[model samples]
Target: MLSILDRYILKKYLGTFSLLLLLFIPIGITVHLAEKIDKILENEVPMTEVLIYLYNFTIYFANLLFPLFLFLSVIWFTSKLANNTEVVAFLSSGVSYYRFLRPYIIGATIVCAAALVFSMYLAPKASKGFNEFAFKYFNKGRSDRDQSNVYTQINDNDYIYVSYFNVTEKIGSNFTLEHFEGNKMTYKIAAGQIKFNDKDSTYTLFNYSKRKIGETNDILKTQHKLDTVFAFSMEDLTPVTYIAETLNFTELNDFIKKEKARGSSYINRYEVVRYKRWSLPVSAYILTVIAVAVSSVKRRGGMGVNLAIGISIGMVFIFFDKIFGTMAEQSSFSPFIATWFPNFVFGILAIYLLRNAKR
Candidate 1:
């Protein structure tokens, strides 16, 4: 039992969003292709591989810039309604402003659900495929090791450190592992170089030395070659930039838990990604409210003026998101705060504008 007005607004909202996505995605693909064409030709990549890359890129780009497109679409269609005086007619017909906003909320909910699904499942797969394709074909000689000066907690009693690690070869230099009991160091192992044997699932330590601490004295052992097993694996030593983007919501949470346990320095960046997945969907509701409030009032300059305003606001929002995201990744800023601060600030603005629009 839906009202005619509700159906009309809902249709316009969803239809406009679809149209905008279709219109802009090709332009995005074209620009991306133009930039990457030289790399494709230089690498002598096949057309079939290029097509698959573009397919994955489509999903990646759409999910990446979802909010901007949604904001512009809302502004475009709502401004059209305002220019036609449809909003005024509806208001004059005894529909309160809050009631008039219902269809917008409904429409946003639908889009938000879709966004959540995309981010949780589809986007991760697309991101993995896209990054893998780019790295395999375009980024020749690029190393996979994401960081230097790596430190990790192997377990409750063991810790490890590596001055540098090579992900391509599964090797590390200047490696140290320490085992502690309460406040006392029980034993320590050091190696000049360590290589992981994937077939054997063990480490080969060159120039290895071990120290066993005792109450009265310490015993030391030295060897030129040593093979041993640890609680961790090569994946633990080499973290990739795209690792967070490849995991779904459930996998992401588990990853965060494991990384936290391991005292990973990259945990901040991973947490930011986790928070943003949910925040992206929630922002759909916030942006829809702000969009309607901004574009519902008819202006002398027409749709172009409204679009200008919408684009300006969209740019500001994106700027804030990037700044805060960088802070979370580089500094000690909490990822939750960084992710939600933009929403809180913009939500207040939405409320202010909605009150003004009501009057």
Candidate 2:
């Protein structure tokens, strides 16, 4: 039961967006492949893995730049409509400006839903593969985890520290574990070096010593080498920096809960990722409105002028998003505020522009 005008405009909106993605994704892949081909050749990476990496990279790249694609696509087609005086004809035919905007809103909703799905599920899977391949082949010898001066609370009464950890080797120097009971030290374990045995799921401590506190005296035990099991996993020592990006919505929530319980210092970073998953999809509507308003008025300079304006606005939006996101991740800034501030600012802009366009 859709009107002809609604069908026409909706078709144009979705068709233009789809065409933009089809055109740009291949260019992105070509550019990426060109930049990384040398490394791929040197590493002798298999063709099968390379193809899989490209597939993941496409999703990662698309998700990262979806808003820009959407904005530009809207501007492109809307400008074309304005240049052809289609908008003027529609408005003259007793269609109010708001009525004229119906199809665009419908298109935005569709895109927003798809974006939500991508962020919640598809993007995380792609991110895991994308980051894993980059770290494994392109960034060998570099770690995605903090390998120096590691400290963490594994559970309520247990804390561990290491001066330096080798993520690849699963080894550490200057390892110490402390147990406390009601603000009193219960026992402490220290070792000059520690190595995890993956096969046995145990730790081997060199120059190991343990001190047990008593009401009157402290009992000390020392050994040249000791093998034992602890209440923590090796992953608890140093989770990869991108660990938050690899988990889907539910998994991410569960992970953040566990990390919060463990007193993780990277909670802000994780929360930033969590908030962005929702924020990015919402921005689609704001950006769509802005794009239509900016491009719906025919200009003397034609479509190029609208495109210039769109690109500048897009760049500023991305800049604000990255700057605030980084601040939230690195500082005590609220992740919710950081993630949504750009959208809030741009939404106000969208309102102002829409009002002007109506005039």
Candidate 3:
């Protein structure tokens, strides 16, 4: 049922996209290595670890720049067709503009599906490994641990607050735990400082006091040092820097719900990541349409002019995405809006260009 022209265009579309990724990935790796070589040598990291880090970095970098690569590849190949007058020949043979676009749409759909899968699963795993290796081996001064004014809901009725927590030492100062029943406090424990003993898997609280609120009276007990076990652990207090990047779509949704309930300060940031996973996949289609429309017409300046325009548009798109993303992370802008704003704007532009190209 497939025609020769459809197959030809589809082949070119996918083949060029593949070739672009293959060529640029090594450049990305080399640049990254150049930036990190001094740190790697100074830290004296093992070759095995370096190899593993590079493997993970490959996945991370590819997923991060997939859209840019896709846009540029489409522009490159489509412009070549225009330069060769293949587009003119196809149109001269009575193929409608919409019909010619079908193969491109199908190709974009395939690539979009692959990108979705990568973002939801493989990229998360790679990001986790890559960031962990970076923080653990190369960047010794930086840590993934959250330390200041920590607050969270450990369970339905239990809440915790820590004024200061040192993740390296597994110690906390000015810690408070409260238990509530139907919005009424039942019991509370306040500690000047708490330390976790890894050997015994127990907590030691210094200058700790416990208060029990009864129906009639309150009973308070004070102790110099108390050793006990709690439902939570040190790991709960210290979360990774890119925790959102480590979870798949389902896990990210559940995490956002829980974090929202706990009034996390970084909820907006997590929501931005969640929305972006879906947005980037949709962008593949929009960018593909734009690329086809822009490069369909053979210009006086030929491929160079088309590529220059494509690169400028690509840069502008990235700039808009970064600005809106930062706004969502820092301000009250909805993550859903921030994540999709560039797509919405560019999608309209694609439609306009497609209309003009059709005429």
Candidate 4:
């Protein structure tokens, strides 16, 4: 808690991290400007708008590589110290290699925990504003990406069949509600359209008809020409809160609950994303441990060589992560494995490297 060496190492790691971000952001801006100059000019977008949008989008790129940046920074700085024999000096001066690891672990713990909060508590809410701002002014807003077909469900029971739903225009078409207490259909309602009134928490149907069956092969039919209201929420269609990347953990969980009650089919993606968010943050700690361990030891190679290796490893990790996630989304792999396998593998590797660093 009070060692100067620990502080020094923490200072080095954080200082380099800050410097990398500061430098990379401006470079990112320049690159974005050069790439988007044509569209910005052609769309007659304001320079200020372009600047603002690009600034927000910069976070997207920076976040994707933040761990790599942190890891490389540790490798770069610590490797330099090792190559200069400072590590040997420390070792000679009553400091064990394991003792020197204290600062790295401490710093990594803080960073990883902070990253977890950022991804789970902050990122989506921020992205909502960021995306709106980008779309409204910078990129010219478009219709929402989520679309769904209508389904017939009694009180959102989802035991019946529905054809499709229109999000832009609040309407459900070819709706059929089937009631089955056990293995038989006790009732069925086929409606032409379902109209939703969100503010009032109700819905209206147009050109609707209902059919009922009783024991002894008795049947009853009913029809309605005018509009009628029933409790309905547009959320039943797409369940915005459970769309994985769109909502943070708390909100997503709430959405999952609501949709689960309705017997939604796509809940797996949301759960996978929630678990992955926690796993990814932990990965930052694992990567940091490996980076510091590899660099903290005195070696014949310098910072450049170690940094190159670190960056390469980090890129490969990121690639496999994306690949596995895609495969999971496509139902080619188990969601649990796809989401956390890379982190699990790398975490083991980090432990091995840290052991060697002690030797």
Clashing pairs in 3: none
Better of 3 and 4 by lDDT: 3
lDDT of 2 at 245: 93
Q: Rank the candidates by lDDT, best first.
A: 2, 1, 3, 4
Off by over 4 Å in 2: none
lDDT of 3 by residue, 1-359 (tens): 66999899999989999999999989988999999999899889899989989999999989878889999999999999999999999999999999999999999999999999999988999999999999887779777777888888877889898998888888999999999997999999999999989998999999999999999999999999999999987866666658999999899999989888766778888999999899998999999999999999999999999999999999999999899999999999998999999999999999999999999
CA lDDT of every candidate: 0.92, 0.95, 0.91, 0.71
Clashes of each: 0, 0, 0, 5
Preferred candidate (lDDT higher): 2 or 3:
2
Leading candidate by lDDT: 2
Ranking by TM-score: 2, 1, 3, 4
Clashes of 1: 0
- Distance (Å) between predicted and true CA of 77, model 1? 0.5
Q: List the residue pairs that clash in candidate 1.
A: none
Best candidate according to TM-score: 2
Query: How far is each candidate from the true structure, as Cα RMSD in Å?
Result: 1.3, 1.2, 1.7, 3.6
lDDT of 2 at 163: 92
Pick the winner on TM-score between candidates 1 and 2.
Answer: 2
**If scored against the real structure, what TM-score would every candidate get?**
0.97, 0.97, 0.95, 0.82
**lDDT per residue as tens, model 1, 101-210:** 99999999999999999999999998998999888877878854564787888787888888999877888999999999987999999999999999989999999999
Which portions of model 1 show Cα errors greater than 4 Å?
Answer: none
